[model samples]
Target: MRKLNWILALVLMVPAVVLAAGKTELTWYGHSAFKLTTPSGKVLLIDPWITNPANKNGKEDLAKLDKADLVLITHGHFDHVGNSVEIAKKTGAKLVSTFDLGKALATYGGYPEKQMGFDTQGNFGGELNLLDGEVKITFIPAIHSSTVVAPEGSADKDIHDGGNPGGFVVSVKNGPTIYHTGDTDVFSDMALIAKFDKVDVMLACIGGHFTMGPKRAAEAVRLVHPGMVVPMHYGTFPVLDGTPEAFGTALKKEGAKARLRVMKIGETLTF
Candidate 1:
């Protein structure tokens, strides 16, 4: 009886140990939106453009989220900022963005100014240590214009100009360093970012009309040479018609080291 009891105890303990050692998961919410859950159980949402046509079921999905720890905004575009304030209010998540964006949200968008923290501010080339220990986020340059559009369809450009559109290299505790490139055109700065940050996974935008097309974005991916590449910011509107199939073909032709991962609207990829 003692021998049988010891074997049963060992068998149950093995599954518990494996569950305790949980790996980080990457869930795609579509249209430049992704949720990263670290091993320590911190949730980070990046450029969440929920409610767009590309999202398919974004607005409905937002209501189901009860815990969002940090929200990172690359620019002040309406699509990217969609549901940010609402999500923050609902979940008590901290917003990570430029100083001007935070100010604009508080002054114009009526966000609670009290929850805003000093860690919210990060410029191009700046690094921020997340509240979750050992996870770090570095803001890199993106060659794109960023200005808030008013309800009347007029551009609200200012001297500050909402800083600049950018990307993030997020380093999780025991997981890979994931890079998310916000809306940008092909620029040499991407090469610099690649050299400085050894990205494991890259979320690059590949839409033609507004951002870099398939060909140029493939070049950018080659320059970065991430382990895996995921495409975003396309197929949402009539203007943005670039497809993932084209991107995959180009990547193959270029002999890029990165593997292309084309996810569905609400797919989750565990890293």
Candidate 2:
């Protein structure tokens, strides 16, 4: 009887152990900076411009960050490239980006050359199984321009080619599939993203002037047909005038089925 009771207790605890082992978390640092914590505790930063103007906790967040597995950059824009070098150096985080962008960043953006190599770099339509296969990242194309120039230099200084811009579709094992739009205008091919994998969440750029506005973003959302949408890359500058309220309204008009999740700065959403 005692042995049977112990066996029952162990069986009962198995589900709880599995649940705890599969927890994932996401944290936003305003603008486009986001940190993804996998169930296995691997940290991935997406376009980690932690010091952008919209995030008041930028300095604190950057300083407190201790461990990061991968730092992913969408483009070479100053706003998008924020704090990645600092974070990578401090944490020895490997960089995940396009081969072209990785070369440019290492040569000019001050990224440690050893940290970014072919191991974590890929081009559009390429996929990488990383973090012990706990996360599968697929590169998706984005319509945007990228330029790399020396910071704090004369206006006429040299501008380096930053390569093609793109986004990422991160599929977490036993978790969710997250699609980060990066910075881009809405294009027709977005409809194909959902065909490959059902997008659980989309980190989309709703800001105008540089990227698509709310109306077009809603269209993009409709195309991808994700389970939920999280608006990003808006209101960091005066020119980026897109608003979440407007995005919601547009989504409604476009008949997009995804739910909207407007996260407050420094707040986290767990799954």
Candidate 3:
């Protein structure tokens, strides 16, 4: 039965090989916008402001997104909201956000009311296994403000309170655990994130005037202790003057072990 034993050994190796082949592709679309492609081919967009000032191919890129499974919004700001409403209508992506923000977007903004429900919405300290167990998302607190403004040139120009600001810790099956620190300043409790799960990638905002600057972001990086860090939400306007170089310098000063990954707009990285 030596031949039978050899066949069984080969069969056992197949699953390991398949698991190793699985990869997650992460694409940044300028500012705080990111697209996550899971190993199972599911698509998730976070604050997808694809048409922001930084991306030269913003229009083309936005047009190409035909199949988004989920859209995760960090807060209610215009920049963070970005082109989510348009993308949702185009792809029928379910909105994953706080209950308050979901209501505001559906009421005042253009998010599909039918697609947003209890299956997707959540608040801080809550975790949900989604995408048929391909992903786990947990909401984390962020120190920021959120407001939903009417579209430009609207007659009423009504402003509404969005909800509490927060971030996301997304754990993908057979992939990396990514932390999107949706516009927030450095806080001491950020260290607790690593206590719950190991963060493979951290998408952090480094712009000074609005969110925390480079130095504080570096400290945040140190607290979370992710494998890599990608800076975002900077250089979009004259007020947002934080630079990647400054962030890198501050990271070095903080003695953080995470690798500094500076992504050019529209660039994708596989993990």
User: Which is the leading candidate under lDDT?
Assistant: 3
Better of 1 and 2 by lDDT: 2
- lDDT for each residue of candidate 1 in 139-198, tens digit (9 for 90 to 100): 877888776543323364433356667878899877789988889887877888777778
Q: How does model 3 score by TM-score? A: 0.94
lDDT string for model 3 (1-271, tens) is: 9999999999999988987698999999999999999987999999999999988899999999999999999999999999998999999999999999999999888788999999999999999899999999999999999998766666758889899999999999999999999999999999999999999999999999989999999999999999999999999988999999999999999999999999998899998
Q: List the residue pairs that clash in candidate 3.
A: none
Order the numbered candidates by TM-score, best leading. Answer: 3, 2, 1
TM-score of each: 0.87, 0.93, 0.94
For model 2, the superposed segments whose C-alpha errors exceed 4 Å read 1-21, 151-156
Listed per candidate, the RMSD to the true structure in angstroms reads 3.8, 2.5, 2.1
Order by lDDT, highest first:
3, 2, 1
| Model 2, span 1-271: residue lDDT tens | 9999999999999987985678889999999889999987899999998989999878999999999999999999888888888898899999999999999888888889999888899999899999999899999999999977655553536789999999999999888899999999999999999989899999999989999999999999999999999999899999999999999999999999999999999999998
lDDT of each structure? Answer: 0.81, 0.92, 0.95
Against the true structure, candidate 1 has what lDDT? 0.81
